[model samples]
Target: MKNIVPVKWLLARLYEPDIVIVDCRFQLGNSNSGREAYEESHIPGAVYLDLEKDLSSPIGEHGGRHPLPDIAELAARLSQVGISNESRVVAYDDQGGAMASRLWWLLKYLGHEAVYVLEEGFGAWKKAGLITTADQKVLIPGRFLATVKHNMLAEVDDVRESLGKAGVTLVDSREAPRYRGEAEPIDRVAGHIPGARNFFWAEGRRPDGTWKSADEHRERFAGLEQDDEIIVYCGSGVTATPNVLALEEAGFTRVRLYAGSWSDWISYEGNGVAVGDEKNQ
Candidate 1:
């Protein structure tokens, strides 16, 4: 709940000048659908930020499917959308906060500490009779700057070194089937990094598609020590962000994101891959 805001919380501050709302709705294969959806109807005054366009850089040989965008370019884009350093940002998506969390993580990494993810998806907002508009608002550009946080990320080498090491937990945020190598819908590799434990990212949310409480999140990660160094990853880097946010909500202080994730791990020939349920160390 620390970095998540409810619909009511957003509703009251909808028209505020300093509060900027971003729509981060994205579907993996249908990239254009997100933009089209936003154009159709969205929360009034919300600007659409595409995942493939704004959040990630072009794919390379090693940086996985969705590489981190260049900080300066992203900052310029943020400024164009009127997001300054003082802006209180609220990002939302219909995909259970998966895409929204990417922006949330990126903003935090950029050292903008006022960013938060919307608790419920956009559909819930429409169902509750909240306003939705097709009109786009013209915005004055802001003076946003980037101050990258290097400590929030874990490179492939950092993960490789942490393998089988004490006081470090490598969490694979993919589904059970993908983690167990039963089925891989995306990515060339079918298995996970060796010694990584599976913790599906959607588990952080309740059955109703809303996020769980802080105590509930703590229970989800009860096996993990608060002091342990937690490294979270998914197929690419996108879905892993929810787990990163969840860990923080659970009161874990040492969480870091493996931005390249499994796709990048297997891009190298020498990396080890595991195919079954591994015991949590």
Candidate 2:
């Protein structure tokens, strides 16, 4: 299956027993908003996955705002939601896959590659005149074994060591204002990692909210060599997953996610931060 599936394609296979649809809509400020939205009306048979509750562990001072959940716990949750190793998982959110991609990346990190993000999210689904249901479906639990892929994730120390290293590229997937240190609505630090380059995650999407073609992504990321060790990060590591998908779609195989991202970086007192533009580097 493709990394991104459209609403029409998904609608055709809605009743497939092997398919599990996940509603990932979330608001960073209001933690309960996503669940409320899900309760109101979501795609038929779509289970809700809360970003703070299901996808991540409680935040400590060191692990950033959204640390990954324990592998065992995540696996159990997947099983409870009727997802098995062979399940074709489709995740979507109101935001342009920012929250949904976190689940997508988490599934991949757990060695489950049969996952795809819904193109254009829930709004697109509604716009396409697809059916939305408020009735919750009771699912019989399935066994899902989790195997963590360490290579897919980059810890804080790993990102620290990669700074200014030859053949390594640290990408700040936040918007330009945050990367430039002009504004920081979240996190304690107002700047970014010392040597990281900015690549706004929204750039990967078109005005209609669908992802750019693979060829377009290749052109956008042309500066980096295919073999470069690329690490992507954003505020709390949620939004950055879209860039991870974009990079993979562009045919770069050596991509890793800085799971803690900027929030974790600033937690260390000694880690240096850079302000202004890349020209200042």
Each prediction's RMSD over C-alphas, in Å, is: 0.9, 1.2
User: In model 2, how large is the Cα lDDT of residue 48?
Assistant: 92
Global lDDT scores for all candidate models:
0.93, 0.92
Residues 70-154 of candidate 2 have per-residue lDDT tens digits of: 8999999999999999999999999999999999999999999999999999999899887898998898898899888999999
Per-candidate total of colliding backbone pairs: 0, 0
All candidates' TM-scores? Answer: 0.98, 0.98
Top lDDT hit: 1
Q: Write the per-residue lDDT of candidate 1 for residues 1-281, one digit (tens) a residue.
A: 78999899999999999999999999999999999999999999999999999999999998999999999999999999999999999999999999999999999999999999988869889978988999987988898999999999999999999999999999999999999999998888798888888889999999988899999999988788899999999989999999999999989999999999999999999999899898554
lDDT of 1 at 225: 86
Q: Report the lDDT of model 2 for residue 42.
A: 96
Q: How many clashing pairs does model 2 include?
A: 0
Model 2 alpha-carbon drift over 4 Å, by segment: 279-281
